[model samples]
Target: MKIELRDISISYGKRAVMQSISLTAMPGDVTAIVGPNGCGKTSVLRAIAGLAGYSGQLLFDGRALDRPPKKSNRSLVSYVAQDSAGRSSLTVLEVVLLGRLATLGLRVTEVDKHVVCEVLAELGILHLAQRFLVELSGGQRQLVFIAQALARNPAALLLDEPTSALDIYHQLHVLEVVRRTTQKRGLATVIVLHDLNAAIRYADQVAVLREGHMLACGKPEEIVRPDVVGPVFRVEMVSLPGAGNYPTLVATGPVHGSQGAASPT
Candidate 1:
């Protein structure tokens, strides 16, 4: 499935957090939204997931998304929020089973239970299935939440800082699972990542947002240069050659220094 956001603008009261943003998430690709703290990356994902009100056209699989919270569309797109709220009461297995609720017409069957268990096991959280959400660590809770989202078998996955509270090992683990699952399932995944290196490593396409606008969007190699990154981050970035791999972006100087902007190659 392909997601198209045309001229999307989202506002809170009189303040517009995201303005006239447009982008696409094609199937079997990991598209990342990255920017500074208040750049509205989460708002964009929320709007696309139909959790926030916005003025724009959101199309899924070439069809306009139904505004009334239809089960079809809800099941098609699964959203994993950054905050872990209201989930403390539910056990890991119970939370993951909730993902299949949209598909269960009348009664829960053995197959449904099997699928949920498989997802929990696959995410390496089967041992934590019986534990209460509130009792788990931040990283464990994150994995459970992601497992819940995946149990739905969504066509497009929307995640807001999926690895924010995780340690380095778990961070890489989450990214690896997302990348492998999305590729194997041909699912379109849109994630908001704070870590620039993780975005560069996992994202097939990178979208840079600045002050509520999409400054640039393209392949990682094309869109992640010093010129493109420096202005968005307000930092002096110099790309150093990596050992036979993609170049790395180094913060060479202070952000407020009067360095001449490097022209985009």
Candidate 2:
């Protein structure tokens, strides 16, 4: 499935948070939303997931759903929140099995158990299936939640700051799984990222947002330049080639001005 957001805007009472934002996530690819804090990146994800109210068009596979998508349309998308690992007493396997609730009636059959185990195995957490959610570390819990989302078998996936609490190793590990699964399943995946380097390295396309509007959108390496990074993030970031020729973003320092402007090098 494909996701298209056209002229989208959001507000809370009288305060505006996003304006005229638009982007697209095509099946078999990863589309990332990158921006500084309070730039409406998370808000965009919520709007797409039909958890938040917004104005403008949100089309899934070329069809627009009524605002806050109906129950029928909800199953077409799976959302992984920034802090998806809630403090539940449920076991890892049970939490993951919850993803199949849309298709389950009373009990989990052998096939459902197989699917849950398969997803956990794919995420390299099958061994932890018997562990309680509250007993796992933050990274492990994050991976388990991701497994749950994948188990849903949705055509589109929305992730909000998925790597915020993860260590560097698991950060790469999770993104790698997301990219591989997105391609293998032909799923339209959209993620909100704060790390510019991760966006360039993992995403096929990147959309930059600033304040309340979209600053730019295109291929990550093409759009994540010094010009775009410096202004949107207010940091002196220079992109350099990393291992295997992947681009790496390094923040030299903060921009020195009351307005957080970058000094010309």
Candidate 3:
């Protein structure tokens, strides 16, 4: 499925956050939203999930959607928020199984259980299936939540700061899993990333937003350059060749003459 946002704008009361933000997330590709703090990156995802109010058009497969798709059409999209908090004492398997709740009726079917286990294994969290959510680490819980989202088998997946608290190893592991799953499932995957390098490495397309306004949108290589990234991040980025001829960014210092201001005007 293809998800398109045309001239979308969002506001909280009278304060506008996102203005004329537009992008298309296509199936079998990962679209990364990169920006500075308080830039409404997460708000954009929430609007897409139908959790936030917005104006302009939201189209799915060329058809307009008035709101978040109804429950019956939920298989079309699944969202994973930044907070992985779980107050309940549910087991890992049970938590992941919640992804299938849209299809579940009076009882749990073997098919649901199978899908849960499959997603857990795919995320390398199968061993934690019987474990309780409260007993797991933050990173582990993040993985479980991702597995839960995957279990839904949605055509589009939206993630918010998915690797925030993860160590380097787990960060790569999770992004790799997400990218692989996105490709394998042909899902339209949109992720909000603070790490420019991660977005460059895993995303097929990149959209840069600053203060709720879109700066640019294109292929990763097109948008991850020094010129495009430096101003948005306020860092002087240098590129060095890496594996498969990919460019890696190394920050030398703050942008010239900015004097380390917290934010640019």
lDDT (CA) for every model shown?
0.85, 0.87, 0.87
How good is model 2 by TM-score? 0.93
Name the best candidate (by TM-score): 2
Task: For candidate 1, give the lDDT of residue 140.
Answer: 80
How would you encode candidate 1's per-residue C-alpha lDDT over 146-262 as one tens digit per residue? 888889888989889989878999898889888987897788999999887788788999998878988888898888888888877888788888754867788777677444333
Off by over 4 Å in 2: 258-265
Give the TM-score comparing model 3 with the true structure, all chains together. Answer: 0.92
lDDT of 3 by residue, 186-246 (tens): 9999999988899889999999888889988998888888877787888887988988778
Give every collision pair in model 3: none
For residue 84, model 1's alpha carbon misses the true position, in angstroms, by 2.5
